[model samples]
Target: MDTDRAAAVDPIDVEVGFLTPALRSDLLERWNEPQRRYHNETHLRAVLRAVDALEADGEAFDATEVRLAAWLHAAVFDPTESENNERSAVFCERVLDPSAPVEEVARLVRLMGGHRVEVGDLNGAVLSDADLAVLGSDPETYDTYAADVRHEFAHVPGERFVAGRIVALEGLLERKSVYLTRAGRDMWEKQAHANLNRELGLLRAGAAG
Candidate 1:
């Protein structure tokens, strides 16, 4: 299980030396909300690690903005709310300086909604791929992840839950690729397709039942 789990981890860790202690603390605190269970510190850390791995290949990208986006991506999502990603971006802008380049941050934040953003730009591609790496993880890790996400939306009716999840899964399927990095795509694309297919199949079965 450990070997299988480790295989899914991105092989690098970004140095966040530029992040102030206060800023780091604030980001951590904000992500502690119950609705953010699956997208919390652990998720941020994993994405950052993946970004670092991608950077090791000498990719030209803004590390700071990417890290910031990873930290703030899900900070505004209330699974029940339609504009959660936009609201989250607004919150991120407020937390940062008014003079900061809000456009990039806002774009990155909004990109977290679905896989379409995977093809946006180099940074967008990296961050989006990292955010979704879990989908291609081994069965044990993937199963645990699915449970975590479902638990976050446990308040919704069973029918609503199934419908919502199917929509999300299909969005991923409609994407050109789930992982933008060549290495990531080669390693995980098949797994991600399988995972999405299984989830969609389950949703169909649930709807039929």
Candidate 2:
């Protein structure tokens, strides 16, 4: 079975029922905050769709773990701090039962902090690709994402913000490949590169001006 079909039918029947209602409510509340414009439920839904597409291919990812991690990954970002991933992982651990083996969740959360870890497994690759798919979206979608990201650090000075964002953009550009899945890379790699280049040009122009 292909990943898309498999992911759709494969029921992620975890005990997420315990966390679903409260978590959803909390997430919704958080989404309403202006600071969460980029990390809103809309972004979560897009990631979930990407996750489903990857799963349908019978990829080796742990569906339940990846799904949970995707939902919880940005739970604690400060918009100014570098420990957002670590803080998110810690929050997941605390919210989940101590007896429940959440090591995979923690590992995935940590992996989201940066692109340093090798995506050796199907699950890891899927999660990583989903996170990055935003960069490969249509120009309007990507532009909205860029704006939201800038809004996230509205408190920072323009130079500091642009410098930090440029560093992140360069890091992605330097990666072996931003989209790990074969399908994702095939379909989106060129577009991602183009988008990055365009953004880099804009950043340079802004800095120069």
Candidate 3:
């Protein structure tokens, strides 16, 4: 499904027995925080849809855990906070049902900090790929995503932000493969590389100038 269409749907629509109405409202409110330019409910929906898309493409994973992770991945987004992932993970562990794979869900949420997943980690693979799926979006969408990220960090000085952004982009480029799953590779690998390279070049050039 397209990001726009997927993002338009409320994340509460995704069926999960563990997610009570009160909890869902709290999570949705976290995502809708005014400071969030990109890590909002829309991004959460896109990630959930991406998980479904990957599964539909035959990627094996634990759906309930992955979707839970997806919902809580950016649940504590604060552009100024370096520990959002850890905070998010802690929050996930605190609020999830006792029977839920709370540890697994928290692990997946923490993985978002770097998108690094070890081989054979099916749940991690799915969640990581879904979170990074935006990197492979079509040019216009990717551009918008990039702009939104900058806006989220608008308080940073241009030089510092560009320097930091360059580091982040290069880290992704240096990954053996930006996407972890077979389906993720087939769907977005090449486009993700292209998008990263294009953006990296522009940032480097701007820095040099």
Candidate 2, residue 30: Cα displacement in angstroms equals 3.1
Q: Against the unseen true structure, what C-alpha lDDT does each candidate score?
A: 0.74, 0.77, 0.89
Candidate 2 local Cα displacement, residue 144, angstroms:
0.6
Question: Between the candidate structures 1 and 2, which one is better when assessed by lDDT?
Answer: 2
Hey, what RMSD does candidate 1 come out at? 4.3
Candidate 2 vs candidate 3: the lDDT winner is 3
- True-structure lDDT of candidate 3: 0.89
| C-alpha lDDT (0 to 100) for residue 57 of candidate 1 | 51
Looking at model 3, the pairs that clash are none
State the displacement of the C-alpha of residue 24, model 3, in Å, after optimal TM-score superposition: 0.9
On residues 134-180, what C-alpha lDDT tens digit does candidate 1 reach at each position? 88888777878888888777778889888878988988888777788
Off by more than 4 A, model 2: 1-19
TM-score of each: 0.82, 0.85, 0.93
- Clashing residue pairs in candidate 1 are none
